[model samples]
Target: MRETGLLSLEAKKRHARTKIHGYYEGAFKFTRPVRLDDDCLSVYLIHVGGGYVDGDTYGSTITLGEGAELAVTSQASTKVYKTPSKPVEQHTKIHLGADSVLEYFLDPLILYEGARFIQNTTIEMEPDAVFFYSDIITPGWSKDGVNFRYDWVRNKLKVYQNGKLVLFDHLLLEPDDELEGVLQLEGHTHVGSFVLFHPEASREFAEWLYENVFESFPDVRLGISDMEGGGIVIRILGDRTQTIERILSHIHTFARRELLDKGEISWRKY
Candidate 1:
């Protein structure tokens, strides 16, 4: 069966007064940021915006309005597994208008042994708008060489604002690459990341995320970097899925409170 999900955020100001717009509208323009529609089951978003199995695939899209600011997140952990037939695939697209801002707090994608999946995200931003995005991929879970085998998980990320290229990142994990190789996973199983944007972006915020978010966890390797549009990206690698999810949640909430002036808008497990 073919299945699809959509989330969108758009806003318009009434002479400088901001008002919420639609739950999901088709091609509209606005001045203030309005949370159009949020996909409640698997993904979470305050102002704006999947699933499983063998021989099946799912996709989603999120669009932002000009001058609107919004954040998107996943409600629960994303599980990617391998089956005898076909591997799972997920596709995401983000469109930002001029002066718009977006942040995504994606929970870790747990890849099971023998599982093969491909994930990609494309971000198109306006010239004056700020955009920040990231994705982290890790090797499959394995114990003995003869029992469990995982390989060939591909991930790609691209950012373009005002038609200008900002960031392009690609990663591929294979079973033969000396899992212990330098500059790779470094013996970590779980991987995650955080992307943020806005004018308040600074070196101070990056340092704060490292000390306050990553430093609190033990046995986790983390790093923070800058984006082209006054934003920051954080990467973390660990063995436990729960710990990695916790860090992602914290960073999501922190950015919402600090940048968007919004409170913690949570998701319910249904």
Candidate 2:
């Protein structure tokens, strides 16, 4: 069966600040949002079921009205079990209006033996729209405790601004293939990526970000690249999931303090 979720928020200026004028939710569920000092709202995404099974299909659409700013994150990591017949499928589409902001940060994904999963994401933004996204992938357990035993994993991303495509990214990992090659995981068991799209993004900022965020993690092989218009993309490869997460934490701090200018943030999950 196909299950779909929807989320929409409109921004309204009041009390000398921006607030959500209206919002909508569908099949997807989220915890109550909390307002931050910068007028940005934070919300946590919830998966009704604990994990994904065979033939499971999930889709979500998100839209932010003009001037709106929102931050979203997953409550926990996503787990994908064996999919003998069909792979678990997920698709997400996001729309941002002028001067909008969105930060999508999700936990690691756990793929068990024989697991197969596919995910696709597309983003459409108008001018002056800022966006940040990051995710990690981890190998799940197997009978023999070996890593990379899954069937395969595929993730694709596309971003467009003013009806012009600015970025396109695709990733695929198969355990049966050689993962220790120079162009592959390079003996790493975990992988992650961070994407930042903002008008102020520049090579200098990317270098600064590398120095501030990636230099601290010696165990991880990191790379940063520039986008066509103005943005940066970060690639992270690490041996342990914890290390990757630690890098992500630093990246988050950098983003909030430097990019979003909201200072340190806490989900209050504790």
Candidate 3:
């Protein structure tokens, strides 16, 4: 069976609202939006039978008003199940106004054995706009019947400013594919990345992130590069989903307090 799910969030006048609309197995329709309490914006996902399963598609969009501030997070990691029919798909879109700020700290995505998934993220920003976003993916759950040898996941990210493309990221992973020659992965099963739209910052900050949070993980490889229009991209490859999630949370908190000068997101309490 094939299914589609839609999740969206929009911000205007510093007020953030979100909605989820879609059906699963043609038996039920899902609709709801968790409000952002303070700090910015956040949305909690709903689980079906304790997991997010096969033939599922989810898309979300977020917008920021001029001079407004917003933050978004997921209440839990997205779970992908294995089935013979099809894989799951996720898509996201974000927009930021001039002088506005957006920080998104998404939870990791867990892929089960025999599962295949594709995800895409697109961001549109105005000049002088600041934003931060990250994505993380983990291997199959080890405690259950799941295994890692047959799963696959792909991700694509694009950032634009003033209608001009600035940053493009394409990430793909499959057990059968031979990427051993490349410096990527290097025997790790979990991967995470952080992309920032701030050009005025120096290389010191990027270097610091690698030196501090990533210092202890020997199996993880780090990559830092310049994004179009003076932005920055940080990529990490590791073996543990919990480690990657922790690193992402650290970066998100630091960005919120140090970069945006706003406290931790209030909606997280709920």
Highest-lDDT candidate: 2
Using TM-score as the measure, the top candidate is: 2
Would you list the C-alpha lDDT of every candidate in the order shown?
Answer: 0.59, 0.81, 0.68
Looking at model 3, report the run of 10 residues with the lowest lDDT sum: 22-31
**Clashing residue pairs for model 3:** 40-71, 41-71
The candidates, ranked best first by lDDT, are 2, 3, 1
Q: lDDT by residue for model 1 over 1-270, one digit each (tens)?
A: 553333344443334333344443321112233243341112253212133446545455666666755544555556566655777666667777777666565556656676777778888876666554545454445566332265467777777756777767676766664764568767666567666666677788777767776556655688788765666777777766667767777776677677666566564334
Per-residue lDDT tens digits of candidate 2, residues 1-270?
536444444444455555654343444567677775555688777777768888877777777777778888888889999999999888888888888888888878999988999999999998589999999988998889889888899999899999999899898998755786789988888889999888878888888888887467765689899876667889898878888878887887797688767776676665
Q: Which is superior by lDDT, 2 or 3? A: 2
Clashing pairs in 2: none
Q: Distance (Å) between predicted and true CA of 155, model 3?
A: 0.5
Greater TM-score among 2 and 3 belongs to: 2
Ranked by lDDT, the better of candidates 1 and 3 is: 3
